[model samples]
Target: DAGVTQSPTHLIKTRGQQVTLRCSPKSGHDTVSWYQQALGQGPQFIFQYYEEEERQRGNFPDRFSGHQFPNYSSELNVNALLLGDSALYLCASSFWQGYQPQHFGDGTRLSIL
Candidate 1:
């Protein structure tokens, strides 16, 4: 089966612009998590979704939002983007069972100007 997939591998946005990145989880996965990775830094957890609801969130501000559909695909939406928001957005998916390891997609590279 195909692994997780992310869209628009690269993007450029001006400050204050809004952007949405998409992801599709691997087959049979029921949970999706989003992360932001700045240059040279490890991925920082943003949020997680299961059963179409957000189950957890990190320290990110409200400007960062997301949704998961019944099909297990997901989207990460960022509003009023800032230069600091430029980073690689990663999506990982796994079963909702306890301690399941996540499978990640090739991240979307977002650049703010």
Candidate 2:
């Protein structure tokens, strides 16, 4: 079975630019979570989508937003990008039920030039 998959394995953008990262969850998964991992830092939760609605979000500012499709695929959008926004954006998926383990993708490496 395939795990989560992300597109545009690598990307580059300039400050004030906008970018969108895509993700396709593993089979049988219904929830998707987005995270941002900076160099030498742990993954920081960005937000989660379930039932096509944003269920939760982290401390990230409004510049970060996302969407979940009925097929359980997802997209993470970052607007007005900043140098600090350069990081590995991860996509994780799992059952929406309690205590299910999440499976993550290799992530998209975003560089702000």
Candidate 3:
């Protein structure tokens, strides 16, 4: 009965530092996707992972990477972070190639200080 969950509800970091965000899939979900949302903007797809492999990616640069564990949990990593990177990072979980509805976590608010 668990839903999607993300860690470090809030985070503060400096430009050029690396950060890792984590997520746990909702019950019965097998795919995990990451998104970034800036103030006043809609979420932008970052990438998605399934079966321990990246099945799809957005226009984001290589600096954005992720991993899907055997248990369906996921981790998103941002390297050489920049001020523009400060935003709400969201994780969503879905099943069957995203044909089913996705459940999202509350999101992690990241601030570049």
TM-scores vs. true structure, each candidate: 0.99, 0.99, 0.97
Over 1-113, each residue of candidate 2 has an lDDT whose tens digit, in order, gives 98899998999999999999999999999999999999999999999999999999999999999999999999999999999999999999999999998999999999999
Model 2 clashing-pair count: 0
Cα RMSD (Å) per model? 0.4, 0.5, 0.9
lDDT of 1 at 2: 97
> What local lDDT score does residue 30 receive in model 2, on the 0 to 100 scale?
98
- Report how far residue 97 has shifted in candidate 2, in Å: 0.6
lDDT of each candidate versus the true structure: 0.98, 0.98, 0.95
Off by over 4 Å in 1: none
- Tell me how many clashing residue pairs each candidate has: 0, 0, 0
Off by over 4 Å in 2: none
Displacement of the residue 102 alpha carbon in candidate 1, Å: 0.5
Residues forming the 10-long window of minimal summed lDDT in candidate 3: 94-103
